[model samples]
Target chain A: MSAKPPASIDALIELLAKLPGLGPRSARRAVLHLVARRSQLLHPLAEAMTEVAATARECLNCGNIATGDLCPICLDDRRATGQICVVEDVADLWAMERGGAFGGRYHVLGGTLSALDAVGPEDLGLPRLADRIETEQVTEVILALGATVDGQTTAHYISDMLDGRTRVTSLAKGVPVGGELDYLDDGTIAAALAARTRL
Target chain B: MSAKPPASIDALIELLAKLPGLGPRSARRAVLHLVARRSQLLHPLAEAMTEVAATARECLNCGNIATGDLCPICLDDRRATGQICVVEDVADLWAMERGGAFGGRYHVLGGTLSALDAVGPEDLGLPRLADRIETEQVTEVILALGATVDGQTTAHYISDMLDGRTRVTSLAKGVPVGGELDYLDDGTIAAALAARTRL
Candidate 1:
């Protein structure tokens, strides 16, 4: 009731509260937790944050976050240059990487084109994709973007852009691997039926 | 996933995942968010952590977290020395302070006496509390400890220890404000009934 917290402690709470899911209450709890274990958590967290702040940067080639100008995927020469998988965000890229199936590189679009937000082809780095296809000799471009209206519109635009040059393919729309037929949505069941493969 | 995150990035995620409420998945999302907003969030947070790491420490007298040897409460001379409020932890002290009802000094016990965990009066600074009662000429000692078994056990021990020196009062048990009688446990309903006052 008497003396307020140190100014820096309040500032720390404010910054933490700005994170994706944390609010003021959770931020205070986290700050208290960190202070209670200063040596174990506070010190290491500070060092780690300083390290990331100084080194983290967007990859020059594909917009993925990396310490260097090139992200890990962009730096890996072993990955196939003939195929490029496109996704709407770096989280999508990380998810595809976790699957460990595709051996190709990725192109992070940052976000889909939204007229309301004024995002356009240039913002999505469409010209960069065009240049990459020619320079990397990419024969196939895989669209791993979501099935939203914006995603479908972007996929169609990309397909038309590379109509005569390289093959463009979108991921199949069907019931998920463990999806139950009874739980499947109408659109999903209809799409699965249209694209059904014979056993 | 293809090329694992840089060492610093992975370490940052691991450290964040260790926080009370955050999990590995949420940690990843938070790290990504911080990295994406390095200038706005990462740098300031790092600076704030470094500041707290260097300055945060426990009050030698009261065991409350403080920047100096004495906590703010101890430093403020206007507070009444006639009463002392004892709490189980710093978080509890903060909660009391937020309530703004107490104008007396505080003594943080760190924890309660627990025979199972081998904790005793010495561990909770009971000796120091006895010294404070005599030194500060305290007339009343308030026990704001929770209603848990350990809390009650500790309260009884303190009440007996200060039997002749000063008045010791534990917080009254009753149904919480805004709590519905229908939703309250039998014990809380009973306590509320027993503590009932004239309207």
Candidate 2:
């Protein structure tokens, strides 16, 4: 598509290239495929993206993507539990929801506290989280942030901010389910051994 | 992404997943990324797709994608050099254009002749191509179709259809440029040896 893709087609390729997994080459292939199925796929996909762009927004309460002021989880009355699950992003919230456990509300930090990158508590919406804990009468704040150094540092910061006003806990660190011992890293094996309990 | 993406967002994800290289998980990530930059990416991409869908059509003369009755190549006067390069698809035509070696017009076959798939000469626009050869006073037809069995079969079918009306040639097969001899496959090595030229 070097010398002769039209301007509009080239623009489409450039935008598609900005997507997470697609590059210039794959974007061109995808665009060609889309143009080939203009009536069925391309038109519909465009319409859908337009609709989503117009309607989608972040939930006022949890930072999850929502069509309205609140996300589906926040809008559901049954989910107004005394506990709040703290996650770094909407993706993590979705993962927790898929587990079918944790009958609680969620607070999305937007990102973890990163001193090196200059990400701070204010940037992560920690003040809003504090307000939620106070107003919602929350009992537990379950931290499902990833097991990275930045994640743990953020978790500790949040714990200190709460100051025992509510219980602060985090997801257990151990061998993952279906993980073989031989393939498991040393740190994970140690964590699994340390966190061991009788079934 | 699993449990609670908005309906419109989910639809966008589903459509994105149907693209050539994107999967469901990558589609979800892309959707999130798009929503995060709705103004910069999502809306613009949607608009571009809509515009392309409304304007793009196949060139009436050949089968190349075009926004008008004829593609840019067909509209260009300088490309009418009495030489028509036949290709399997628009991508192949683009490849040729990128090489900047051929100044002649192009004929996109859309796909190779496949008896098993019931794809015949008419479906590949061979009759239109024949008409073009006569009308354009073509002195040569260069077959740049791939070296696949179906590609060769299509080339042979076109050759027989012309029946020596003009000179017909297929792309030479051998080790590609920048390809090392030791890494070359047996068939490619054999072809290279058989078609060796005086350098």
Candidate 3:
């Protein structure tokens, strides 16, 4: 029992463990599952990863991930709605897409303006955002950043930088669509109450 | 936003979501992380998966996953200790290996007998177990099956079948190590009390 598994299997487990939600134990289980169903899962996953590794790239325009220079959102001609939804990372962009409410394009900031981590506006593609407003004729900049302190700070910085260029708005604060008042924290409840609208 | 990502990226997400612990949302995150860090994580993982897919196979003798016809445990002469640890699945075999306690080889039954699923001894390689006892001169057969009804039933059936051929034993039933008495369930507490020793 002291003998370890094969090197490839061990390496796969190590890499799988580094994924966001999977720890070492579950990674090992996942690797085992993949190995057991090789033709069905492991082979397809390997092939898919190889293909992505060869083709996946960040959009040169908006920093969204795609297989080409411009992401699908950035390349779509019909997405010219004169509105650019700004987000902290590609994950946020995907989240916004999942909501299926935004009909415009996106500007991925890559990260927030964090003074502690030394992340500045330049690092977040603020210059590119301003350029996009002029070149793409954007009339609105929707700040879909998180509710965190850094997120707010970043939003404020972007808004001030684009004060005269375009309208700057933010995603509204309220109890989530399916969330309950009982489960919400004090700050959320307060914000939701303050922003309450008439029926 | 209506435009889908490239076919490869979508395929990767779909395959990843089918893994043991990952769902659609987390799969997207995992795929994004892989694509973003292609050189660091994605390429290596893809290579490892390809290697494992090409080499990994079930041991013809004991059903453990291996690179060849027989698993490493079966091939190692040191593991010929005239004892066989029987388990319901390869996961249990790996768990036992992680403990580094067992000194003998293992026999993965693939799954426990289930009346509802129409599983039987033949399906679990019971005949091979009997043959191995005679050919390998196995003096002990340890049943390391789960505590479920099907697991227990399978264990009892195996024990009865090998009544006089070899000494049959089961994993000890008691409170797990590092477990608190107050948090233990009624069945575990009762079992611990019944199996209490002079220590």
Per-residue lDDT, model 2, residue A133, is 88
User: DockQ, in order, for the candidates?
Assistant: 0.70, 0.63, 0.64
Kindly state the number of residue pairs that clash in model 3: 0
Would you list the clashing residue pairs of candidate 3? none
How does model 3 do on interface RMSD, in angstroms? 1.6
- Please rank every candidate by DockQ, starting with the best: 1, 3, 2
Model 1 ranges with Cα > 4 A deviation: none
User: For model 2, which pairs clash?
Assistant: none
The number of the candidate with the highest TM-score is 2
How far does residue B95 in candidate 1 sit from its true spot (Å)? Answer: 1.7
| Model 3, C-alpha of A128: deviation from truth (Å) | 1.4
Instruction: Assess every candidate by TM-score.
Output: 0.95, 0.97, 0.92
Top candidate (lDDT): 3
Q: Report how far residue B197 has shifted in candidate 1, in Å.
A: 2.4
Residue A147 miss distance in model 2 (angstroms)? 0.8
Q: Rate the local accuracy (lDDT) of all candidates.
A: 0.90, 0.89, 0.90
Per-residue accuracy of model 2 over A79-191 as CA lDDT, tens digit each? 87888899998778878888878888899998999978899999999999999988888999998998889998999999999987999988998888888899988988998
